[model samples]
Target: MHALPDIVGYLAAIIGTICWIPQTIKAWTTKETKDLSIWANILVLLTITLWFIYGILIGSIPLILGNLISICAVGAIVIAIFRFRSQ
Candidate 1:
């Protein structure tokens, strides 16, 4: 059924979004982002933003929700990188 695929999509989105939690937590708590690449994070943010836009265009709730959350998670990492940059 159509509902089953949407359920799967939502599940995947949730798991994927959650994957960033540990990294975000570590970056914020330790205040250490030296090992993290700013460019990579920025690129990821950009990529997710595009996906979010595409999701909106297609009206896919799962994609929209997932990418929206990803943007926040990755955006936080980017902020952490700048805020905690090594002196």
Candidate 2:
């Protein structure tokens, strides 16, 4: 039988995932990446990437799913920074 998502785990995932929204919105609004640090984004993206791998390894859906969403959001910010900065 498939185990349901733990309530606390679900809440944790939601909180972490939602926390990324403000950064995303800020990037979207400004369309300027100069205010953000490339090193910080790279570090965060790397950390999230590892967390995602760990989540998968542990077979924790909440962890895996949450990190995946975070990667996308943060990834977009990283890409936007590089893309806009390049021009």
- Best candidate per lDDT, number? 1
Model 1 global lDDT (CA atoms, 0 to 1): 0.89
lDDT by residue for model 1 over 1-87, one digit each (tens)? 699999998788789877887888899999989989999999999999999999999999878888888888889999999998964
Write down the worst ten-residue block by lDDT for model 1: 10-19
Model 1 CA lDDT for position 70 = 89
What is the lDDT, from 0 to 100, of the residue 62 in candidate 1?
76
Q: What is candidate 2's lDDT per residue for 42-84, written digit by digit as tens? A: 9999999999999999998877888999999999899888877
lDDT (C-alpha, whole model) for all candidates: 0.89, 0.86
Q: Tell me the lDDT of model 2 at 3.
A: 41
List the candidates' TM-scores in order.
0.83, 0.80
